[model samples]
Target: MDSPSSSTGPQPIVNSRPGGRRRSILSDFLSDSLPQPSSFLSTSPGIAREILTQDIAECSSSDDDDEQAAASDAESASGPADAKLAFHPNGIVWGAGCSLVPTHSRDRPVPNPHEVEESLHAELSLLRDNAILPPKHRRPRTTNAFARLYRRNFSTKVRDHEGPIVPDVAVETTPMLREIPPTPGPEEIERRFEFAVAHHEIRTTWQREAKTLIQYSTPLIATFLMHYSVTIGSVLTVGRLGLVELAAVNLATMTASITCYVPVQGLATCLDTLCAQAYGSGHKHLVGLQAQRMTWLLWILMVPIALLWWFSEPILAALVPSKETASLAATFLRVLIAGMPGVAMLESGKRFVQSQGLFKATTYALMMGAPLSFLQNWLFVFKFGWGFVGAAAAMAITQNLLPLLLVLYVWLVDGSRCWNGFSRKALRNWGPMIKLALPGMIMIEAQFSVLEVLTLCAGQFGTSQLAAQSILVTVTSTSFNIPFPLAIATSTRVANLIGADLSQAAKVTAKVSIIAACMVGCFNLLLFTTFRDLLPRIFTDDVEVIRIASQALLVCGVMQVFDAIAAVAHGLLRGIGQQAIGSYANLFSYYLVALPISLSTAFALGWRLTGLWAGITVGLLCVSVIELAYLHQTDWEVAAAQAADRLRSEDVAEVKLRRHSHSSYHMEV
Candidate 1:
């Protein structure tokens, strides 16, 4: 044999017996006669098996094996041969050399199996004793049956390929042969665990807030829808009476809404800030007292409003073109005056319950009241022939019952914990409530006055136009009930967050509310736009009214988006105790920006009813823009602090009033 060339790298060891093929160096070295105990390689059995299998597969595929053997024989004849061996111990190669001994005989004596076994055992013991081999427990575990099967199939496929190529004999260390990576340290383990926990917590908090918003808003929206049905029912009943009656009732209803109903409703919203903050801060008793104070204040305010309703004919006459229409509207207003207190009281009770997060009670009360009011309208207007007067009476009676039902539910069913019973102390805290109520009242009044002005302008177009305007306003207002409760819920939820001193949470709530409102606005736009031709027919069957109202409905479809934005923004301001800013924005937008545009378009430019609505649209757009801009710039942390201060200041004032009362009593005694 000739010495293997140095540049040939490692060669596979072959069995020199007559028909035996080449085998891997690892298996050959283990099977060969060792010169000494130290000459044997040490490696895991699994790796040794893999290397053997790979080399055998490569040798089986080579066509040049005969040529290589002939070249080796020529080299052997020309020069003295040395055997070069490459040992792979645990898959790491180590170079070695040994002299070759040639045998001319065809047969060589086979090594005894017993002697070979003893030699292998002796070599393993020596390696273990010398610490050259790893301890048994430290060795890598062998591959299971699945891994062996995969390797067998893979090797079979690689060997059967038909090609002209030289096979390379090399054992590349794979992942199986490499040392196992060290276990992670305690610090890294802790860091990974903490990251997992934080990720879970963030996911959980988001789900919780989403659930809370849904739970709070759903019942509120339902309640608003039910309550709005009462107004729709009235409009539908009055429409059956005749065109003049429908126009009269619509005019009176809108006027009352602006002058009496909305003002009280606006004034009562002060409870949203007061009662919501009180309940959230755990001053539960203050919630009830705030409710009572709102009731008293609203009742007092209702005095002048009743006078306005009684004398509304002259007002309507001056604004409306038809004297008969004004007289019918006045009659309707006078009938509704008796129910103004009921409306005020009902709103106060609603705020009190809503502040405590008892939205379901409001929903239940409105559900009952809406149907009963509708039934009563059918009975009084259609069955008993009470006409517009019956519609107003039915509404007044239902309105009176609504507050009583809400109050009874709150006191007897749930929310009694917040009520300390009726208290004179509620009557004493007028100044603080008024301070908050005034700005809110101003903001609401400005918007309502714009609608009233638009209604007046619509009246100038004629009875048919006025009837159409009424139908459009009623439909739009009904649609408005959807986003309105969202605004109320936003206010309550934001106030609660502020009262709890969760500044970032309040900001998030505000943003979520605005986005939700805009989505609802889009929905309303689509709804009204799709049904513009059909919706007016619900209130009136008159062809002319339907045609005129359809045109105005288009304007309403565009306006609803801006209206929703402004409504929610106003609610946010109330929540953050910034009602004055909303008031100013409303004043400027409605009076300066919207009113002039509306007047010039409807009268000077002759756009009529459509132009009036166009003007209203411009006002709503201005208010929405201004208020949203202000909201974007607000610092929620400061707003939260202000809410806290507002609650504390009221407490301080209550204390001073008590002290003064006690001193006066002592002096008198």
Candidate 2:
């Protein structure tokens, strides 16, 4: 029994090449078992090939008169001059369909309907004869079944006219067709569509998704590295001042991240959903509204956070063994209080632009910020002779400047459509945002607070051990920036494939992602192990600090493999919408399994800084194992079905929203 294509299928796009193609060692028989979503051709690459080949076949025919007659009949019966027909296996034809690609320009025209249909039928028949398409997908030999299947998918108008296809009311009323962009002639669009389609068709699953993952991950990795440079600059500069200063800076940054920065970022992540939904649903102004609301909420929460930072000297003095390090750390936190609002706004602003698909804006802004941050750190700490206070001042100024640069980009270049000046609407819609924000904040803060615990544990040994802990943390963080972002990209692609009901394709993506993670982990392991002694010198001149840090690097180096695989596993969990399970796994592994062992090994057994990292490595290994097992056991078809169900619910809500908006407009008029 053949069914019509799902309404929640992927939207059309002209040319969206993910990256360069590469082949894998996987056998053709194995690769052929994995099937892509029906909508992928329209949205990905293959549709262009179908269009071009069909067009060429019809135009280059031996019978010129028959071709001319067919063309004339199609043109007259096509209804709209911009009508483009795409063929689906179920016999449905899509005409003048809107694209999902976020473009400011007009939509591109495609080949005529009759020509496309004929070409597709010829190709499918050839495939069937050659036994390329799996036996299950081959057309029935009986005419009765063929006619019945065709009747089920096609409109009555298509059967009656037997010329150009026309969509029914249900197809015409789809959200995609509601707001049609202007149309451009065929000459203006790229003719490389067929090339893109062929490239998509020939590649193995591993080869295809690996390239796509790289394409998504490369820029993200760069962005994370630059963003991390802000903290790196402060650590490197302060490490040179003294052992006490190095320990204080790391302690201060870790405390600040746990108590403040992590929460802000985590809370702001709600905008990733809110702003994206608003923009995609045509409620553009809501993007700014959501951002504004988040910013205001963060500012309100920061009131208590500011007070805590301001009077933190007494608290820190009691907590740490060294009074000098505690006082210095307190001073650093106090100076950082001014930068809280900047951090809040930057987090929100990133989501706002990202929601609109303006990803490069943040990258461009950070390109300027990273170098300036390093320069400011050098000038203030060394040139101006402000010491630790100068380092704090530079960090504060840089944080504030990042948001300003992002705003300037939005104002001058693009993404301004979402912003319609400040409005009071941001103040009222507080409940929904807060509910989403708190859970995310708790989860993030829980993960980040582990660093603070590890630092505190290391401090119990002595000042040199504490300083070594700082370097170890920095190296771990910098290494993490690579795999974490790659994981995020993997999650996005996998989730998309799942949503499209391409279970086999999603599985392929998952396998490719884990392999990529393994490769990254090995590279980090090599770098750390090979340069353990030399790497610590880049930060400080102190002999004891360098010696301790170099020793700890051996443990840290081994942790990288588990760390990368664990991160990618977490991403896969998110992609499958099984984040709760991953969260539970993290809590169990880190708290129940890692913390007690670290305290026992570091203090009781006297393994020192190396023992502290060993515990974390154990936790990461457990997380990777547990999550990978869950993924391997997951029923991918069920996951895809759940994703489709979710998409259908969202579509229903969107339709209602449009209807409500239409009614409101009518009432106003």
Candidate 3:
């Protein structure tokens, strides 16, 4: 019998005897010699067999006699013994003959060697002539499953040999398994980061910033509107008494706002910087103490302010020509004096609540007070015939109610977490509070005084002009309420960020606030310009007042844009503890630039109310430009460090004060 190595390729051996031992042996040699199916053919068994048969047939015809004899000898060795089969590269079966018995199994009869050899040779020749082989270049790619499996399992390399595809040990392995992707290097990661920054970073940042501004600004704007509504409701209620009453009450309200109310409000604003920074630094208790200090300071200051209101008659007489109007305005101021403390307290509470981001509490309190003030006015002025004094009394009641309700809410509701009751420490820290409060007060008072100066100029224009100016001022003040709260929100947010040591975030917040302020200004400009003619009808029926007020409104429309910018920029300055900068800007713009121009244009140039507003416009523009420039050039990192230092100093002060108090208590014991 021939050795297994003599087999040239895979072939079936058939016994030709009548009762032949019909067994077959599968040899590994035949599988090793035969061509493997392509990956494409392995997935389609019928096509693979047909192609294989055709290629093998063609190869067999061209093969030499020595090769044929070797195939025949290998087939003759598959007698009674079972053969171990090798798998094709494509995992197909190589031999298709009947099972052969083991050499020790004596029950099976052996087939004739010569007959088996001849039968196998004949079968081999037929299969060789009928089979087909695909070209090497046309083989399956590395991505194919069958090709990968074949490459992994096979020891021999698949290659073309003498016009037929065969397994050869000489060729290097063609790696069929897919190569693993390499990990991204630092350079690649950096490149991707740069791409994101260049393309999407700014847009994402702006969107987040705008959303944050809107979130904080919206509730604050609503709160301002509600607070302003109390005053407006009183104005509307008292207007029904007569034009003289309206003019008198309006003048008194403006005067009081400039001298008393504005200064108190400004003093309370010191809490904006201190409380906001304290809250951001996680010193929540300090925010409450700071607010308490402001409340005490404003109350102390209100003593002098109350005297001013009591003697308002002479001041009004000096400013205006009419004795009757001066007396009426003084009466209005005296009645309004009852609420001045409440206004100051309310402002302090508002700063405290705003620092803790509890804006809704203030909004709800004012919302309740605004309509209630109107109802009280209607009852006192119209129902009881108390006249302009009754309007002032009703407004006082409502204003006082605002602080009471806000204080109750803070003590009982969400904001109580920051409160540790009123501490003696509040009384001891007057220096720091006064330092910030004085500049903030000056900054705010300077701006309000510009309007007061213009109003004084308008009084010189006669009753019609004065009445028109009152209406215009009231309308502009109401509209100014829109951007005013945005400023407060901006200050709170910027201070919080700075105190938290997020300097870049604070800078970005300032920029976004400025942009928002400008946009609001543009919107106000459109609303004021569009409604200029119609808005005066709500305040008065006099044709001359309406005409003059409408013209003034046009100038106000332009001024609102600058007012919006200045308001927000002022808030940014306060956020970084730079209230002195705003104070200086307001002093320079309103006093040096605005007041002189307003006097010249109103008195010298005879431009009347329009010139007054024009001068105010120029002042606002100057303040806005200067504040915006300072904000743009400021180093946020330095500002953050300053905020930290302020907090640390306060802490040190508290520690020293506590030690002194403890030592004094021990000595007393």
Candidate 4:
């Protein structure tokens, strides 16, 4: 939300400095808060109406007779003016019945292990005093169900969630025009366009796509936090059990997560994008059909997945170093994997619902899952004699319970029946889905592979290094997610636009997404740059790890823009069903290029961790650059023609099939 500013003295009173030298707190806060004072102050005079009444009251409380004595309180309250904001130290600027948070502070300082614990007491008090979210809404949102569980017992409903919660809007919204032009005058339209462009450039310099950045990047942050939450619990419970338990738990989680999730997530995007497209095109059946296929596919996948669950220990042994690890990983993996069906169902169901613009379902499901997962984890790991295995079981058990119920819940609501009547066309829709899906899968695989190598490399440095790497990885992952939700939203928009025959608008939306990503990337770059030294202390006190992690942050931090570009490019293409291209880019970048280079550098060249990180840089940079270039060179008109051609081909294929009176694959399975 802010960066440390040089002191701006308090506002001038009647007896204050004669030269107006005591700069108003306004100078500290607003001067820094506004993108450009000249434009923002008058650009939208009504903005003052939108200030949070609570924040205003908090600010207005400054009339406390001893306000001057609490100037530090004032400064702290007004910290958004100058002090650099991180996720923990949220800053707000309040005065004159208004509050300003220059940005959603993305820098999450890794807390020392005890700091979070200490905060728990205060958090508990708040919980005791404050109101809970509506009982129906009290559960965590779907995307975050598992993680939210960690905070359930310790957390209160009192603290506001950091992200912008999309409240249910009952007002009718049917694609209304959203243009709010700069205060217009005799200014030429073209000139006005130029001016708007220039103004955007300047303001965006300090702020990225603040909203979008926060949206997409929150997942990454959540990922980082997830590692910590799991690690904190595991380490506390398992650390005393010895290194073997720790290693076993880690290995078990990794193998299952990589095998279970990475590919699944990539493949699931098809549902997200296609469903969005179908919804946009008003082809209701496609959305439901795709969801059914995905659900059935999960069922099919579950057979093999459950087998692995049955044999999880051996798999852990194969992947990790120790027999003890094998035993530990296997024990945990089995339980966790048992929950795999639920996890898959939950995710797929969410994508289905989210695609159909029923975002509430996903949120509601998460709300339920969070506390349940946490309580389960606690009981199994701590109360039961399960150790790391118990922790894993907790996760699995809760996971297992959620999905089937959700499926049935939706079905009971007539969702399942909605897909009952499948047209013959519904029986034959796999080709395009797979074609558009592979690239995303490839990218996910490539990324997970990179992470595996990096984790392995970090292993050589010892546990502290691994923990630090995990910490930073979590931070960046979480930060990067700032744009991801936006990317998802953008994908939906792109599908809608493309479906509606607005190719140019689709292109514009893609461009808008990229620009938004870059701006977010830039702001985050600034955040990491400013807080590089501060972030390492959050995880551990090991001085060597801090120094090493800080250096890694420096090198890796600058590449976020490239990552942003690459990710959004992939998202855009996939939305248009050009997934294989992005997949290929990912494959080439990570496998044919980054892997070899980074491995050789880290191991062969003796560059150590730097080499490992450099590889990620090279791969991501190459991917981003080449992908952007490809996007730039895209001939959408030709592509649009090709879309029509493909549809024509499908039509012909359908006609031939009907003419031949061929049977379908519906009976095969």
Candidate 5:
């Protein structure tokens, strides 16, 4: 957060002086201890002054040619800063003179890499020992290759320019100077330098980042799979009740998911950012408050959705060719209305715990709830002879049951501190939350509604094809669960890298993620191809349903890679703050390309279920291709700059709010 000073001294080497000034130990230790100031600091305040000063003092630009060269250099440097502030966690301004460090270039002498490593280690120890930043806010440690390279590049720039850490300041008696740490001896510095450069290759960064991604995503994958199982359980149990029943359940769930479940999940996503910021900023109760607000908002929103469900039979009848299927779907939706509040709370509560880094809360709840849902489905549908109605009832009960388990886990185990019990506060200040919720809901809806549209289109082909559509939806959704969570993890990682001003590292991570996604896609592709005959049997036993699904499974198999790529690309777009591009691309590709191709081929050309999936497959391909192109063309450096600006703006807003009053400012999530 350091601002450049106009009257700063010429760059001075850590242990040397051009005017025979006495070299100070404290300056040298600080030079070695603080991580290198970012090369992207040319946009900071007073940088123009610094550049003009250097041009006048050093270039002696009496000639227009020399003046033009300096002007060009200044032009190149003038822009919004892309780098984050290099302020120390304990409030030390170690990078006070960062703007004065000549921008990195090929001409700069490479500093001893060992010295760089040791210097970074010292600063990392400082950050760790102080514990000023919570776990969520901690940047990557010095062990990361990119982090080391940043330190190395910083050392080279400061050494080449001889810029002081703080311009024109007394090393001794400086404000907030701590006891000087011991400096390395000549032998130690030389030895470490040799060691650093000798081992400077960052070959391990890929492996290290990959390992980190896998480890972080593993729990999420499990959690998402179990969550999906709740619905899959219903599909499996309901599919056993005969072809009509299976088709009814499929139609019902599709209606519920697109109209209710997906939107609720999407709106709840706002808390991912809101609650995390609250927890990281030490407002733990704000996390719960935010969740409560979202829950209430969703419940209020649900009033209309519930009403729609209650009267949806006519709507479904108009859209779907099978009036019987439409009526059954309406019945299922009406039954599901009883669980709307529970679904809202569960989605909100998941974010509540996830933001606190306690992912296992939802996992544990689903661990018990998933099987119980399955058992309930069995009892109601077969043992209890309730048929399709029984399956709907079981799913509704399970939906309600999940939030209770989540609440119990919070109260009994960890994450209880965030909750302060019910208050009218939850009912107040719905604007900011709504603003974030609407866009997220729209984005998620855009992604999911296309699939439901395809289902509606499939309903024209007869119940067998509709049942096959259900089987296809179930298989693909299950497959999608894996990469979707992985994509979330990727988004978090890439965002962290961008925020740290490590664009090169962020690019590397994006590559790794895309590669991982491709691998996952291929794995899914192999499974679908290999098990196409057997996969449908898990859901139903009707010969025609399985046959239609099997033929479509080939199309679904081809779609996997594209679907996987699209999922990861969406995540990558989110990480770089370019999700608006993705939102547009999804709407364009699905509605224009996928829908047209699907309708024309299915109805116009009489291609049946295969044509439906064929259209979706092409849409997936279009989406993936567009997303990847955008990601490829994006200037990561600018993205990082914008991210820093956003973070700074948020901090400024928070500070202004805190300055006015602690309690009077309406809390906006």
Candidate 6:
């Protein structure tokens, strides 16, 4: 009796795949596996099981012409012994049933039904397959056929990520997502709300955190372009004025990049990390108030930024003996000053929105802002009498004012209620904001200050070498900064995961992002090396400018690997909320080590641009090596431990819910 059962058992088993003899058990599988409620659990258990069991094969095939190709393809589900279907983790079809690549199919026969096998990957009849009775109960169907079972993962994909908990009320609906519990403290709610409202000010600020970050970071690559192109174009326009004028531009830009631009980037990044955690937690009042605080703080920073422009004339006059150079430098400062307030606001507003997770909008702003700035530069410098001053002014008008105004208008117009809530009360709880935002700000501010010392030290090398350094640094920064957006994406994604208490998922995402950055590094290195000589010509027509720039670029060629690693680490830090440590690391490595090393090499060792770039390389290398090592060894367990805490707090509620529902009703024990 058992012999026949073994011999004939697999005949229907082979036919169990979708569209294979329309097995009745398919309905039961559908009912059991499709995430239905208890009420409907019994209604169509058999029918549900049958449909689902057979649905894989039952899913419609390709159009007439494509079916053969799909059927005959070595990786298709129905391929022969020599030709197995490629198995995709995401299933065979993503959209419209188009077969995806890289699937794995096996040639094994189905196991005997009554005999149980024990392997995670082993295929046995699940609810849907086992629901229907044997041949004794069913109408006769084909008997001996291939019983090779397609392995099905019967368990639901349990959520692997938990976003940061806040006043956990409503969350954006996502697949297999677990709801974040509301923050435990009433104070947290108020603080978060204030920050959101401040950043979302309808008429004044109104930027979401995510969108703002994207807007600012997306421009990083473009700014690198601006530094290089303007340096080149400015050199040409200053041709009649002489090398001193060109050198003035290099020095001013160096000062700006290190002191104003990059630090501002780091400082505003405070908004990115703090606002995100605060907002994700959904303490609405805190968001509004905190955003205002951040805004005002950055506003005060404008004093120094403006002072940099105002005092620029005298500084250049003292640094360079050339009268024309000093005069031109003063003029550049005036124009930069006019735009300084707006630039700072734009950065501030942008970060406020980005911290809320609006990356798409932020990127769009850059798409709009870059072209306008470039256009103004051409019009003011080349088309008008202003020359370098005109170009510089144009950049200010396009980049500084435009980005600020647009982002501000968006926040004000759309997020009006969010704007009106600012007050001193929101500032009262300084602890969390300081804990989250200050570390990042210090890290960024210190990073820029160090870069400033290095660049200024290089300025002593004269216009050509400084100009070459600027161009080389600009290129390397721009090329590798392409990974910045991905990093931002990674950080936010990981933060949400961490908040959701999904440590494993956070790790995977971080690893993938690092991998992506390294790949980008490879491409950048190749690009710089392949076009090393020609790359500089795009920035300047002067033979000397191009010559020195090329040599620096050649050395800068291999710098991408380290740069990519460091940048990604910075992003990972932001994501994991390790802002202070990263800040400390930047301060320690760049200032304590790289800057001094570069200074010694350039001045003491008699190296010029090579020594300067070598310093940058060494600084970044030190930062990268230490940062990456820390990132790899990060103790994700602390985050995992949060799960136990969550359970300790929320699990009791779940039990009470079950008990309450059970007590008040006729439900059985």
Whole-model Cα lDDT of every candidate shown, in order? 0.60, 0.65, 0.59, 0.48, 0.63, 0.46
Best candidate, lDDT-wise? 2
The number of the candidate with the highest TM-score is 2
Candidate 4 lowest-lDDT run of ten:
92-101
Residue-by-residue lDDT tens digits, candidate 5, 90-183: 1000100000000010100111122234334432322222231122232322345554454333321212122323222223443334434455
Ranking of all predicted structures according to lDDT, beginning with the best and ending with the worst: 2, 5, 1, 3, 4, 6
Write the residue-wise lDDT of candidate 4 on 289-360 in tens digits: 566566566667767877876777665455445566567667776776667666566656665554433434
How many clashing pairs in candidate 5? 3
Off by over 4 Å in 4: 1-249, 266-327, 351-357, 382-386, 408-447, 460-464, 498-508, 529-551, 575-577, 640-669
- Mind giving the per-residue lDDT tens digits that candidate 2 earns over 130-207? 233322232323335455545444422112222323333232334543543433223222122223223332112344
TM-score of each: 0.62, 0.72, 0.62, 0.55, 0.70, 0.58
TM-score of 5: 0.70
Off by over 4 Å in 2: 1-203
What lDDT tens digits, residue by residue, belong to model 3 across residues 1-669? 121112111221111245422111112112222232111100111221222222223223322322432343354333422110100001000010000000000000112232223323322222222221112232333345555454433312212111323344343255643333443433343343334323322111233345555765676556656667777777776666666666687788888887877677666655655665444333455567678878888888888888988988988989987677778889988998899878777878877776665646776787677778888988898889887888999988987998898888877787876676766666764664566567546656655666777777788777678878878777877777767667655665565555545454454566667778889899989998999999888877878878998988999899989988887777777666675577678778888988888888878998899889888889889898777666554556555556567656554543443344334334544
lDDT of 1: 0.60
| Per-residue alpha-carbon lDDT of candidate 6 for residues 46-96, written as tens digits (9 for 90 to 100) | 221122112212222213212322322223222111101111101001100
Better of 1 and 5 by TM-score: 5
Candidate 1, run of 10 with poorest lDDT: 96-105
How many residue pairs collide in each prediction? 0, 0, 17, 28, 3, 83
